[model samples]
Target: MTWTCTECEFAANEDGQDACVACGSERPEEEQETAAEAAENGDDSAPEVVVIELPAKEKLGVKLMPPKDGVIDHGLAIDNINNPLLENKVQAGDLIVAIGGQNVDGMGFSGAIDLIRKMPRPLAISFEIDEVRRQEVVREKFQQNKDNDLDTQLTTYAVVFDNGPMGLNLEEAVRYGIDGAVVRALKGQAKTSGMISIGDIVYKVNETDVLCMPYLEVMNVLRNATAPKTLQFVPKEKLADVQRVNSRHSESFRLRESTSHVKQKLMNNPRLVKDDGNEGDDTQSIAQLIMDNKASPNVTAEYLLELRVDDRRMVMACTSESDKK
Candidate 1:
């Protein structure tokens, strides 16, 4: 029996040589059969790409990151739409593994862009959500547990006794119509699987039912509670929704405005200011301030705060400038 490696197409005719002679790869079980079938039928055309029923890729509105070191596993998630990711699902930190069945890994920034653009629009975009999102979804489902009656039952979490607080903050979980305290921010070291998470609408704490309760009262319940507390919650948004929300913040460079543009913008920048009670120059005179920042290479908040006595006019660095010298 003749065997061929799919990757390097190396022929391994020897009985003991189980791997490819050229690439040193173990041959796939179907590689020989597939090759033989193709040869017998004389069909060398590539397989057609599969089209999945999903939202249009463009309207779905995702921004793919430039491939790094010659590969793109996913793109950064941006929340163009609100908490309804089911409408068009994708999340932050998800790698674009494939588009229209083309494996794009290792195909650096330009390669990925070119391939996607050339491929058909509304192309099937495959992605892997980040680990944080995966855990958040699982915890959300577990917390929103319902019976045949569909009542959300309380879920318990084993609290790891760390110096940190309950890993999550609260907000109004009104969008989903569940009147519970929503999880806002999950603190560092508190973000873990099997614990509370961001976007979880926590409704219970210990014996106290916190749903429909004030924020402070709920906090009090959690603050006084001991370890191994039972805290029930449904996610403020679904897993799909949070993944999109979590994915929305994109990292990109901001263009530096021209010096004249900077001077003009200082009108609202709040960084540059006029002298207190001694209106010597118009607010437009802040052109000098911009020049000052340019003049001193080491100009910083500290340097600006060290105000100099210029004709008895009091200047400020920032919000703390209300104090008169």
Candidate 2:
């Protein structure tokens, strides 16, 4: 006889199986009956199903990944930054088992996403309370804490500048509800000699952590600090791949930003096919090749020649402007 899951109403349970395949609920005892049978027999022993309604227009705010081999639960939460799931105490790496009171087992990645989009406003999301996943999350958090502790010990670069105008361009950024400043540009002495990078995050001013202070307050502190003020900076978080430097600061140009585009352009041309051996060394070797005006199998000499021509034109323009005076 087929058994219906009390939790998600999945009715495809096979005989001899101890759990509902669609919802993972345990099989009912032989003495008990399905919900319909129980109603006919006037039995109230079956568990009550609870449905949760979410706030209006609120989303689950998670990125889901496909399940691994033999995994039977719903999609996995891989990214949950500023997620509404956090408000409900749902964490990244948790298994999303249900949506809108329906079990999500057997649904592939595309099916799960489609269901989420079709779900009513203020979507109801449920997670599987698996002990194994819970323990794994605990261990991951422990490791993250350890990694953060190590990061705290790393040396933070300090930039010392005189009082007037600071000579450093600063911009505010917020992440995970923490406020911090980013180095946008370097001016005057800061541009010529400062060790602080354009993309680094302002960790501290003097001895105060910028993240602890309000964004406006941090700006005010930098604006009103005494002469010979110290600003400590650290690299931004790993996930923050933004490059702040613009064309004026080509000295700080990063190959990472254009790596894919450059590869695509090279790949589009049959004659400029990239060398397989140098694919992994693209960033390092490309920089050296551009500097030397040399071409590898993947890079064309015309590209290097164009760069040289641009440099020459810039030099000629500068010389002509000097002559005009």
Candidate 3:
């Protein structure tokens, strides 16, 4: 009995067959006849497309504030804020304010840092202050720039925690308060300028916590707040390890998901075409296919467990890899 794949239109050979000769699509003889009859009668079914939706739940937020004109009472000293090279003129004890937001006018804290670097200064007088105070001063400078020019550039900081200088340990860094984090795990002399990361928490700026908030909210607070804010939070000790593991797991999950989708597509639409004389057949267990196309080395056992319930091929690959030499 001869048969043809309903999908690729590949026909069976002279010998009685159960699958298409060109593509490894299997079909019972009776089913093939039924499908052929239906096709003769113009009956057809639309192909189904599968869409995988993976939900990402991680969140981070940064807030911008207006500049405040306050004397350097304590903490970081004025000498610290003065960057003649960058032409930053704000000195210790100088009054400044924060500014900028999602829709506000002016640059926020991050932009001020760039200004400092671009115009580095020596012996510039700002009052002595700590890290947290310095952050506030920078925020204020950003606001000042905005007030002076409606076209002032805007910048924000990002908080990130990762491995420290030592292997397997972690550190934290606050980038521009919205672009980076304070890496405190590394050992070095305290920096007079540039990024600061002594311990876990930011020593400068107000006590208004912006961690995990939406990016827009952070911008809104800084742009609209009339007073100085304080943000407080303990640093995560194992943040680096956690992030590394999460990143690896996410990628593995995505790849396995993609492979499963491909397999299902081929199974449902087993259609092969004979363009030339050569036959084309593609068939493999999911495990074999994924191993051949392993996306990363960080895929964990836990990630595999999550895949087992929905992806049989992934489970098979896990078991198969363990049994190998």
Candidate 4:
């Protein structure tokens, strides 16, 4: 029989073992009995393997570390905001010891993987985490990042990227108090400066908490924030362990039934073809186009362009669908 330390999850031989060699913690009484029963059962299962795919578009959201010392530490090192493992109540740094009632505590990396692949679903995992260690990490983060004026003052100068100026593309989500506009797109400078990232929910601009704020008022705040302005943002990914999109979409080649059909669609879209609206073409050539063409700052047109760029992907999706059809 094997014994394990509840604190560090270190395993030991024999039912009488009292302390863990790794952390010197007292072993739980029930652990030894469980191992003894497992030793008798002698690990037998059918060879055929059944693979269960997780929910679509939702990432498992785990970064696996390679085994060291021939032992698989099936531990969650870092947690992605929408990680399914976390939504399953698995915490960062938790060591997985069993899957589907099968003990895999002593297994090597490959052995553990094999066990997981062979186990039937819905998967029931048993794991342990060093609560003391986890707490220390959290406390350290709070002290370093949040000890100062994180709430009252924001830190970032949204610089201009080669692509454009710094500011998130936004959409209106009235339920979230984002009646004016919601940040949906972020330029390179904002992300590089650590001011914002993709999928951030903007709450306040310069600490005004712009709920029910007029659209013009919101724009005024942003325009007024010349340099070194801070906008409060919340990362949307952390809200759920696994984020399931309400609808999943993609330009699948299979959907066209043949490569030729895929080619036909691309050929059909004028924008997709070279020389159709090629940037290399001069302004004069663009002006001569059959379609309505205009150049240089039309204030009204520029504002509309800004709105489109704010949700560039949405615009692209619409354009793509329109072109394909």
- RMSD to the true structure for each prediction, in A, is 21.0, 16.4, 32.3, 19.6
Q: Report the lDDT tens digits of candidate 4 across residue range 230-301.
A: 666555543221011101111211234356665555545555434434565533232133123323221211
List residue ranges in candidate 4 displaced over 4 A. 1-61, 73-81, 139-325
Is candidate 3 or 4 superior in lDDT? Answer: 4
TM-score per model over all chains: 0.24, 0.32, 0.17, 0.25
Q: Over the stretch 91-175, how does candidate 1's per-residue lDDT look in tens digits?
A: 4433455555455654566876776667656555545435665456556545544221133222334334444455566764433
Residue ranges of candidate 2 with Cα displaced over 4 Å? 1-3, 6-51, 61-74, 78-93, 101-103, 106-111, 122-124, 156-325
In terms of lDDT, the poorest run of 10 residues in model 1 is: 246-255
Count of residue pairs whose backbone atoms collide, per candidate: 12, 0, 85, 7
lDDT of 2 by residue, 115-213 (tens): 777767766555543445656877887888775665465456777877566677876543222345777888876776647677677767887766445
- Give lDDT per model, in order: 0.49, 0.55, 0.35, 0.46
Ranking by TM-score: 2, 4, 1, 3
Query: lDDT at 213 for candidate 4?
Result: 54
TM-score of 1: 0.24
Reference-based TM-score, model 3: 0.17
Q: Lowest summed-lDDT stretch of 10 residues in model 2?
A: 298-307
* Candidate 4 TM-score versus the reference: 0.25
Error of 3 at 39 (Å): 60
